[model samples]
Target chain A: MAIKQRKLELGVLVASLALVTSCKREDRPFQTSAPSAEAIQFTRMTDFRAGGPSISGNQPSPAMSADETPEEKEFEENAYMVGEGKRLFSAFNCVGCHAHGGGGMGPALIDDQWIYGHEPAQIFCTIIEGRPNGMPSFGGKIPSFQVWQLASYVRSLGGLVPGDAAPGRDDDMHGGPPENSAPNQKPNDSSLPKSAEMPK
Target chain B: MIAAATARWATLADNDFGVTSGEWVRGTKSVLDPAGPQSGRIHQLFLDYFWLSVVVYVLVVLFVIFAVILRRRRARWTGPILAEPAPSREKLRGWLVGLATLATTIALFFLLAGDHAAGRAIRSLSTDNALKIRVTGHQWWWEFRFEDEAPSKIFTTANEIHIPVGRTIEVELHSPDVIHSFWVPNLHGKRDMIPGHPTRIAFRADKASEYWGQCAEFCGYEHAKMRFRVVAEPEEKFNAWKAAQLQSSVQPATDSQKKGQYVFLHTTCVMCHTIQGTTAGAMMGPDLTHLASRKTIAAGSLPNKRGHLAGWISNPQTIKPGVRMPANSLPPDQLQALLDYLEILK
Candidate 1:
């Protein structure tokens, strides 16, 4: 009976250890781990040009790929990063022109039409180098990591990122439905002028 | 001890106690200094209540002593056997109780009437020709927007409020995030600024002095740091301040100041703040058009000095944790240039 009792105790201890080890642990609630600047490479994933061919239908453009880098995965899938990016969107006054993605001074970010390519790299370039006319360059202003986060949030607004990673109802006045409910949109080829300049 | 307390109360009613010392003795000055007409009426009622309470306390203490002495005398004269009181003594005791009850009733009735009158008087303060100001409470700050009939005269400021002495100022309160109480104890009482529900209060400062105000309600993390100053100055001075606030930002005259302006426009500051005559015109944060004119920063958490401003820019969370403004890690040269540029904003 003593041997059987000892075995039961050892089994219980092993089960508790397994349970504790199985649960993921983070040092802090929000992931502040900075993404490497060089981790984003979209050349193979997207056939992006200054004025790329436009396609019709609900299908993703032929240039799109299924593979995603680890950095891109964290940016697009991590709930904390996406939530922080949503806050940055308002803090950086993106909502001033974008007006919660419906767009006022800037184009509607949630729509399928892409004046520039809708790939993650394309969006990053747009924010960093800026487009012509109304878009002001923020290359040297905002930190590169924050620009990446903002780009990830913009993708989520278009329902490009997974729904679970998107933000819920905000405390501010409602401009549209919660971002988690954003309808899925397929990225389209660019409609920019052929001679339109592109960021290096 | 009672006399000493009353003397202290008298000093508080004078309004000169903290003015000369330049130190705000929070509760005493805030409650007793009646700088405005509305607060003066309230203060008078409060004094009446204080005197009545003092009188009641003295009378009650004297009655207790008399009863104790009478009991001792009866114990000495009467034998060890305790007998019931005579009919005459019982009648006298009944009369004393009835007199005490009547006195208490009369005193309470007087106070009730005075309170009703004071409330009516506070509400009856004139709104005609009163300057209209809209106050919006944020998570840990206050925004004041002045309205005028002319479009050019309208301007917005934060933290500090400037008013002309002897002129009634009507303030409408709003809160975008949470419930916050607006209170300037010397000038007026507390009013809650609730989200979606706006409130209004009016008062006229008869004295030209600085009165401190703070958010009385318990708000988020930095609620204690949320304070403001109300400066009641001459009309001409107030007009001049308003005119300066309405003008566009001053042009950078020096190279450092110029660099500072460029940095401000290019950096994350422009994303939240607005400065007139500049390309940086977003409204997520306070308007810093006349920042240098204000006496304090961070909703009066720190005095508006060069070192404090630098520290605040370097790390706001150190001074006020959970503040929405993030820390900017700028190099030494940029930080100094920014300070120089901000200093001339007055």
Candidate 2:
């Protein structure tokens, strides 16, 4: 009777141990480190409505400081690289269908005839969002930097000096300057007369 | 029994048992002999294989029957069933060996012969002597363009391909949209027209006659409508036809024809067609710059008669569903004028 009692006690102890082991195996530990502020901001921005302004109401606008040196201004002005854009343009075989400057299967990029508008931002959008007939969208195919380079190449078509052109002038043919300008600031106005702006 | 008899009678009527009439029949004096180099090679190959098959079949059947009867009679005298070693094992092995040797020889011969014939077909002709013609395949039509001419001098004709008899003609085939096959059965076998790739077929017709062919590939909704005609004429006649095609489209002589041209330009016709001299420069469809010159319409499915032409213009989709050419609901007077203008496309 004492041996029987000891055997029952041993079985119960084994069962309790097995149960505790399985419970511990199934449990998952919570993450300790917090996500970066930039990542959290990006997720919030993407959740906004379609065609909404990229910036939120709370964030302050980017500004140029008085402490900015001549070297910095020159670098900012020279930010649009014409040489890199030209290399990317030729490598992508954009000329094969466009035919040097004359249109064949695709429209002429050099001419004033803008199907989606010749502004830099608009051109960028057009490149990212392709036209229906034949042009395929390169949004995901190319990197963001490469797209900006292509936009610069197209902007050069209008006789604009490559490095001198500002980054985000909305009305200027590079897709009406960049969208992230200061709250009240308007983009650079086009010098061409209203009559001359019309495409032939 | 009645139904079977009626079916037999219909079959008999369709069969060309004996060549009673002057019209051509299979296994009779050929309308066009397969005399060209490529066709001659193919014909000889076919005959050799056919005779070989007949001889082998007869010998095998006779041998099998003779062996079976002899073996059964010999075994009959022995007890009800004598367990003997397989007697025909050696014979079966010998037969198999003989058959394999025969098959290998025939296969090797065909492989070598086919390679040689294909090589000879594609071998380039002397530049000075060879005639070069560009054949473009559309949805349900063919556009023939003769080389050695300017863009303006380029004449667009459909359905029919004109060639000079006994002269080697090299045709470069191109397809604008989907795949299409060019075939002229009596003249030459079919060659496919693949997009972005030009395929060439070289052959000479031994006889001067019109041979019929249809697009062998099911290109689209109008695959059946995509028929072609090979009009093999004498050298002098071919030259004259070429010269006539190069000439400008004749202007409308009658007031009704003038009205038709106006209707063609103003109506939906201008949206899909092109006429070289007029404002109709749209290229969504075939160039009707020289439409009347073609012997048949709707590819080669319909004769180029006024009635068929009118019917096609009224409701093309009814005849060939899914056809790119839509039905033009025109007033009677406008439709008549358009028909008149289209008839003179030559």
What is the per-residue lDDT of model 2 for residues A1-200, given as tens digits with 9 covering 90 to 100? 99999999999999999887645322221211111212222222123322343344533323222222222222122333433355456555665676544567987554455665554445555665465677755543444444555665655544443333423332113322232221222223343544677787
Q: Residues B101-199, candidate 1, lDDT per residue (tens digit)? A: 998999999999999999999999999999999999998999999999998888999998889999999999999888999998889888999999999
A70, model 1: CA deviation in Å? 8.2
Please write out the lDDT profile of model 2 over residues B29-116, one tens digit for every residue: 1223453555555566556667776877887799799989877887787645455546687688689889879986986687678668
**Tens-digit per-residue lDDT, A4-106, candidate 1:** 9999999999999988753422112221445544332332234342233323222233432424435656667766667767878887778888888888998
Best by DockQ: 1
CA-lDDT, candidates in order: 0.78, 0.61
TM-score: which candidate is best?
1
Candidate 1 at residue B197, lDDT? Answer: 95
